[model samples]
Target: MRRDEVQVTLLYVFDELESDLGGTVSMREHSQVPESVTTIRDELRDSDFQVEALIAEGNPADMIVGVAADRDVDHIVVGGRQRSPAGKVIFGSVTQSVILDSDVPVTVVSVDAEGEGGDRP
Candidate 1:
């Protein structure tokens, strides 16, 4: 598809208290405007597509679904974390919720050090 025809919005979700609880958190504290979204926006800026970055609060799955409905997005892209078999069964998956509830198509992207599609190193 033509770049002009591509309209995309990147949503980055972060815990609200990550910054405040700083001092040895397992995950690095991310910005309100996430770096990944910024990188994507920068990469797409030269293209003809329209790109937006959204940072939201509350449960990740719920926020994603709500935004997808509110914005009427063609597709919702989310970064997924690989879960242990036990975790998957116990907590249920966030992506599953979005896939089930979204009015629009949802694209779940798994992230890793090597990039999308690669397993965690």
Candidate 2:
């Protein structure tokens, strides 16, 4: 990040039920902010970056792209985890949807199961 003014929005989206066909489901009902989001914000603040934290509930990919568009952000950075080919086919990736749908440039930070790999600025 340049020394010039820059604002970073740290957004975390909670998954919501996809359909009403199933009986009432309950889990993750509360809207508490995730510790991971707070930790990331703290790290960014420590690095002298201005940060805004936002929590949303919805389809992750849609929410991410909507926020970026609504906020008019210059770029989007999303984290993804590696999965087996079968798993990938079974659980389509939110990151992939955001990459395909986002108007702004997207940077994917992919990590392994051990969280050992990712590109960093």
Quantify all predictions' global Cα lDDT against the true fold.
0.71, 0.82
lDDT tens digits, residues 3-102, model 1? 8778787776553333465743323244445456676688787766788877666566887888888888888776777888999898778888889988
lDDT of 2 by residue, 81-106 (tens): 97778887998888899999999999
TM-score of each: 0.69, 0.81
Please tell me which predicted candidate would have the highest TM-score against the true structure.
2
The alpha-carbon deviation from the true structure for residue 36 of candidate 2, after best TM-score superposition, in angstroms, is: 2.2
Which parts of model 1 have CA positions greater than 4 angstroms off? 16-33, 113-121
Model 2 RMSD to the real structure?
3.0
RMSD of each candidate relative to the true structure: 5.6, 3.0
Error of 2 at 102 (Å): 0.7
Model 2 clashing residue pairs (backbone): none
